[model samples]
Target: MTETAAEATGTAAPGTTAEPRTTAELAPGVVIPLIGLGTWPMAGGEATGAVARAIANGYRHIDTAENYNNEEAVGEGIRRSGIDRGDLFLTTKFNRQWHGRTAVREAFGAATRRLGTEYLDLFLIHWPNPSQGRFVEAAEGLTRLAEEGLIRCWGVSNFKPAHLRELQAAGLEVPVNQVQIDPETQQPDQLAFHRGHGIVTAAYSPLGRNGSFLSAPVVTGPGAEYDRTPAQVVLRWQVQSGRVAIPKSADDRRQRENLDVFGFALTEAEMAGIDALDTGAPPRLDSDEFGH
Candidate 1:
């Protein structure tokens, strides 16, 4: 793939030393980087190289999932990064097909087995297995893991406010909720609900799946004054909102650009402009339609 990083406004933020700044607390004293490297479809040697380069470029947070089919490569990248496991914050998710307590435990065991790790910094229920119709059953396993100190943090992905309400109704406390977030897909209602009640948000598809967000008005309007690419501006917007954005890219240059967000800060007006881009806050990846 080709590499490109251009601020639509011609004024890119100055590059800085490769150290991630602290952001929201996933739990007491557990602060996560505002940005994370994501491996969705990249796998095998490509996955390995992408992760290796990302970590070498100073990405401390990594986002993966069983569905990506690249945990082994992800593990290889982490090992090659030469950063101690303690220095890197690892994240992965459990697919909705495996939702029961017994199944959830089996799922985590297998994920660790593939990732070649003993534990993850954060683990998420990829989606609520509506098939079971009683999604709370999986929380039993999470509570046990928390009690045992196996996984440090736990949460859900692609979940709506209603889903969080469901987890709360069952008395399960999820610290982070990963969702598809970008200028074009902002989830303000979801963000408001989570932040108001002490839950953090992780943004996926922050770049609009490659070249899909270049024409958004927010990217071309006020974002132009910042001289940032539509993608970078969106990631910046997510960061300013205090949401962790995990933008995925196999292209090395773009992967590095995704981590370049800490360089600039978005003003309140810019943040609000991104917020206004939300189109009724549609769901990006609903649990009900997921497969494999």
Candidate 2:
């Protein structure tokens, strides 16, 4: 395998801003920005402006979902930025109601229309919906869509190792898997499975929600030494560990801070220190029983 962005690290003079062009190739000819803007829990005008400002701040990757109910706003933000659509990486996922070969296409068309885009950089099944038991067919649908050139790449979210094994057994390939990962709730087993299968791990909620752990000595110690915020320390660790991180922030300064991580590299000890913070708790939402 070619060296993934996650395996590589770069440095800049401390306290200076570095342009974030780091990306991981999830599949042939499909490269995703390592740091992306996650648009969820934001809607309407808020979503639009956050996305627009994110692009203006040099974010080239944007993540949204059909369930987010804000693809229209995200698309508008893209237009407002006046950047070429081809220059950005846009990702979205659909609910289980759209699970199936033909229904997946319907969902794709609807998402593109809502986002006002010609095609997507990546499309994902939001959850396995294992009880529904049609995710294999859904994965097949996304695969067919990719073959048809409707999407550059396709993947799944919140899928555990067992769910991925099913796809493997069905003779399907998963190029990427987005799940929750942070210093706490590291999901090492899922990540190990992804690495063993050459699947890229995309971390949603890269920062813990109600993240009291940011104040932990392990994280804050690095922040002080690197002249970065505690959140930046965690994001840097995520990147150094070879995972893609999409952190959400509607505030311009916070967005810029999120992107400023590439300039500083973390030491192995610091990396381990943060890694030691993993609580081994299951992800907040279980794909087995909880999926839209």
Candidate 3:
């Protein structure tokens, strides 16, 4: 019932050539696949089965978080997938409630136990929790985890450029900045800042939350030209534009379809069309006043 990356490659859909998944090296020896399976709304058996299916479909990068409340299911899916842990990149985050040094250590241990992994490929601070004003202390905990080999690398999520600057001022090295980004909420400035500082931009909601963006002419128009679905077009735009997209789907067919994106390339014009679709609308959650 499970498939290896090689097996998945051999089963590429008709007319589509199988190319190796694209990746970005966040650090000297850390390379993360550009496309990953997001485990947010997925929970319980559904999350477990979806993760297993995603692995079978050739997704090596899996993203989950403490707040997702599905780490156990994500772990079960990995076990069922029958893939070597080393071949997969597993990521999880520390919850906002666990912000201080002691809490981060305890939380990281709990996540490892729940996920059944000896070491995490990457770990993240779920939010800046700027109100708490203890992110510096939390980053220190992540630093300790990295040094002890509990986590390979550590970063932050929902972090604005200002928050990142504050962390940097305190001498913390952030390798990735996960944020909600879609054609509707382009985030060009944030992306630019992350790039300038060598932080990988991991897009959480690469496909607009409501799927409203899919109906846009820019997205559907390219889907028609490339004979691809709107979802595929949007995902391709993310990968092509150089951000890691973690789109969630529980359907097995959709899982396979999502990973099949590497076979095609989007033209510069097509990319521009998607870029022009940004409405600059407000994001779903404003980190400035959000989080635990």
Maximum-TM-score candidate: 2
The C-alpha TM-scores of every prediction are 0.86, 0.95, 0.91
Candidate 3 versus truth, CA RMSD in Å, comes to 5.4
lDDT scores in order:
0.74, 0.90, 0.84
- List, residue by residue over 1-292, the lDDT tens digit for candidate 2: 3546555445444433355447878777888888999999899999999999999999999999999999999999999999999999999999999999899999999999999998999999999999999999999999999999999999999999999999999999788899999999999999989989888899999998989889999999989997889999999889878889999999999999999887777777777899899889999988899999
Query: Which of the two candidates, 1 or 2, achieves a greater TM-score against the reference?
Result: 2
Over 1-292, each residue of candidate 3 has an lDDT whose tens digit, in order, gives 1211212222134324456457767665777888899999999999999999999999999999999999999999999999999999999998777888878889888999999999999999988889889888898998898889888888889999999999999988688889999998988789889767777788898887788879988888878877889999998888777688899999988888887787776776777999998888767888878985
Ranking by lDDT: 2, 3, 1
Candidate 2 displacement at residue 223 in angstroms: 0.8
lDDT for each residue of candidate 1 in 1-292, tens digit (9 for 90 to 100)? 0100111112233332134454556775555777888898899998899899998888888999998999999999888878899888899988766677778788889999999899878888887756566567777777677667778878888777787788889888777888887766676687788766777778887777545556767566645665666677777767766678888877878877777766666656666767776666576566666534
